[model samples]
Target: MYLVGLTGGIASGKSTVSSMLRELGCPIVDADVVARKVVEPRTLAHSRIVFHFGHEILLENGEIDRQKLGRIVFADAEKRKLLNSITHPEIHKEMLKQIIYYFLRGFRYIVLDVPLLFETRKLTHFLNHTVVVYCDPATQLSRLMLRDALTQEEAEQRLAAQMPLNEKRGLASHVIENSASREDTHRQVLRLHTKLEDSMDFLLVRVLAVAATAGLGGVLLYAAKMIFS
Candidate 1:
C-alpha cells in the first residue's frame, strides 16, 4: 500500500485536494479530524488541556471550546507548543491505527491529510510520498479572510502559525499547484490519480506473482517428498 502525506498552508486547499482524492476512491485518514476526536470531553488529552489552560476553555455543553483555545494558542507561540505537546501524540496514535486498518483492508493508496506535516517533522517514517497543494501567498491570504471572516491582521496571524508554503514545497515529492483555476487544479489531480493508480497496479501484480510462485514451490516440495517416501 502506498501511504501519501498531503499537506498545505492555511487556505491553500489541502481539504480540496483531499476531497478530490476521495472522489477518486483514495482512503483518507485526516489528522485534523483525529485531533478533534482525541480531545473529546473526557479524553486524557482534554483533561490535560483543562488542567493547563483552565476550565474556561470548555463550552456549555462540556466540550472543549475550540475557538477559545485557538485564540490562546495562536496568540502565543509557547501556548501553541504546549497545546501541540498535549495533542500531537494522541493524534499520531489514532492516525496510525487508521492507516493500519486501511492497509489491512487492501487499500492501494491511503492519504494522511495533515496540515502540519512539515512543521511536526514527523513525515519521514510515515509517508511513502508527500504531496503539497500550493497557491500564491496573496491568494491564500484573501481566501482565508473571506472564508473565515477574519480581518487582514487576524488572517496573517493564522498564516504565520504555519511554516511557509515555499519551504514545504521544497520537501514535497509532488506539488499540486492550486493557484490556477479550478479546471486546472482538476486536471492536475486527474493526472496524479492516473500515475498513482498505474504504480499501485504494478505493485499488486508483482506481489501476487511472488505469492503464486512461493505457493507453487511449496506444493512441489511436498509432492517430491511424498514420491521419495
Candidate 2:
C-alpha cells in the first residue's frame, strides 16, 4: 500500500479530517498517539526521559507529566531536541510496526498524521502523497487561542514554534482548506479519499513483493535442477 503523510498547524483541524478519513475506512498511523505510547511509565524512552529531565516531570502515580515536560522543552530548543532524541527512535519503531500491519492487511493507503511532517522531513521521501490541512493565519491563531484557552501571546508563541502552514501548503501534493464550514472540509476529504483509492500507486508495493518471491522461487528451482543433474 502507498503511504500518505497528512499534517497541519496545531489547531487547523487536521484531526477532524483524519476522523473523516477514518469513517471512510482509511487506516491511520497517528504520530501523536504513538508518541504517547512510547513514553509510557515502563518504556525505555520513559526511563531515559526521567533520567535526563528528572523525576520532577513525573506525576504522583509515576507517569510522565506531559504538561510539565512540555513546558520545560518548549521553552528551550536544546531540551526539546534532547527529548526528541530520546523518544523519536521508539516512536519511529512503533509507527513502522503499525504501517506494516496495515500494509499486510492490504489497505490501499495509510494516512500518517504527523504534526511536524514538514518540520521533521524524515518520512517525506517515502510518502507517495502528502496532504496539508490548512487554514488562514488569523483563523489558526484564533482557533488555537480558543481551543487551548491560551492568551493571544501564548497562542502565537505556540504557533511560531512550528513551520508555518502556508509554507507546508506549498510543499504538499494536496491541500485541504479547513478555514470554511465543516461541510466544505468534509467534501475535500471525500474527494481526496476517492483520488487516493483510484491511483495505481498501491500496486507498486504488491508488485515488488511478488517479484521478490518469484525470484527466490527461481533460485530454489535452479538449485534443485543442478542437484538432480
Candidate 3:
C-alpha cells in the first residue's frame, strides 16, 4: 500500500486540501478525526486524560472539553508531552486499522492527514511520500488571526508551537501552493492524484509478479518431488 502523509502549518489550508482529496475519491485517514474519537467520554484515553489533568477539563455533558485541554497542553511542553503520551498510541492503533481496512478493500493509495506529521516524526516510516500545503508566513498568520479571532501575539504563539511552514516545505516530497486561488490549488491536487494513481498501478504489478513467481516455484517443487518419489 502507498501511504501519503499530508500536513501543513495551522491555517495554511491543510483541511482544504484534505477536503479536495476526499472529493476526488481518495480515502483519507484524518488524525484530527481519530483524535476526537480517541478522547470521547468514558474511553480509556479520555479516562486517563481526566485523571491526569483533573475533572476541571470536563464539560457539563461529560465530554472532555477539547478547548480547555488544548489551552493546558499548548501552553506547556511537559503537558503537551503528557497529552501526546496518552493519545498517540491509541491514535496509531486506529490509523493502522484504517490503513488495513483500505488495503483489504483494494485501495491503490491512501492519504493520512496528520497535522503533526513532522512534529512527532513518528509517521515518517509509515509514509511513502509527504505533501505540505503551503502559504507564506504572512498569509498564514493573517489567516490564523482572522479564523480564530486571535491577536497578532496570540497568533504568533500558536504558530511558534509548531514547525514553520517553510521548513516543512523543504521536507515535503510534494507541495501545494495554497497562497493562490482555489482553482490553482485544485490543479495541483489533481496532478498529485494522477501521480498517486500511477504509483498504485506500479504497486499492483509488483505484488502480482511476486505472487506469480512464488506460485510457479511451488508448482515446480511439487512436480520434482513426485518424479523423485
Candidate 4:
C-alpha cells in the first residue's frame, strides 16, 4: 500500500482532517500516539528518559510528567536533541510495525499522521504523497490561542518553533485548505480519499503481498512434508 504523510502546523486542523480520513476507512499510523506509547511507564524509552532526566520529571504515580519534561527540553537544545535521540528510534520502530500491520491487512493505502513531516524530512522520501492541511496565518494563530488558552505571544512562540505552514504547503504534493468551514474541509478530505483509492501505486504493494504469501506457503508445505515423511 502507498503511504501518505499528513502534516500541518500547530492548530492547523490536521487532526480534524485525519479524523475525517479515518471515517473514510483509511488506516492511520499517528506518530504522536506512538510517541506517547513508547514512553509509557515500563517501556525502554521511559527507563532511559528517567535515567537521564532524573525522577523530578515523573509524577508521584511514577509515570512521566510530560508537561514537566516538555518544559525542561524546550528550554535546552542539547536536552531536546538528547530526548529525540532516545525516543525517535523507538517511535520509528513502532510506526513501522503499524505500517506492516496495515500492509498485511490488504489496505489500499495508509496515512502517516506526523506533525513534523516536513520539518524532519525523514519519511518524505518514502511517502507516495505528502499532504499539508493548511489555514491562513491569522486563522491558525487565532485557533492556537483559543484552543490552548495561550496569550498571543505564547501562541506565536509555539508556532515559531516549527517550520512555517506556508513552507510546508510549498513542499507538499497536495494541500488541503482548512481555513473554511468544516463542510469545506470534509469535501477536501473526501476528494483526497478518492484520489488515493484510485491511484495505481497500490499495485506494487499487492505484488509484495503476493510474494510474501507464496513464501509462507512454501515454508509451510515443506514443514508438512517433512512431518508426514
Q: Find the candidate with the highest TM-score and give its number.
A: 2
Model 1 Cα RMSD, 1 decimal: 9.0
* C-alpha TM-score for every candidate: 0.86, 0.91, 0.87, 0.88
As for model 4, its CA RMSD to the true structure in angstroms is 6.6
Residue-level lDDT for 35 in candidate 1: 94
The model with the greatest lDDT is: 2
* Candidate 1 residue pairs that clash: none
**Which has the better lDDT: candidate 2, or candidate 3?**
2
What is the C-alpha lDDT profile of model 2 across 123-207, one tens digit per residue? 8877999999999999999998898788898787778888999899999999999999999999999999999999999898788
**How many pairs of residues collide in model 4?**
0
**lDDT order of candidates, top first:** 2, 4, 3, 1
Q: What is the lDDT of candidate 2?
A: 0.89
Candidate 3 lDDT over residue span 95-142, tens digit each: 877876886687778899999999988877657789999999999999
Clashing pairs in 3: none
**Candidate lDDT (C-alpha), each:** 0.85, 0.89, 0.87, 0.87
**Which 10-residue span in candidate 3 carries the lowest summed lDDT?**
220-229
* Residue-level lDDT for 226 in candidate 3: 40
All predictions: root-mean-square deviation over Cα?
A: 9.0, 7.0, 8.2, 6.6
lDDT of 1 by residue, 156-193 (tens): 99999999999999999899999988889989999988
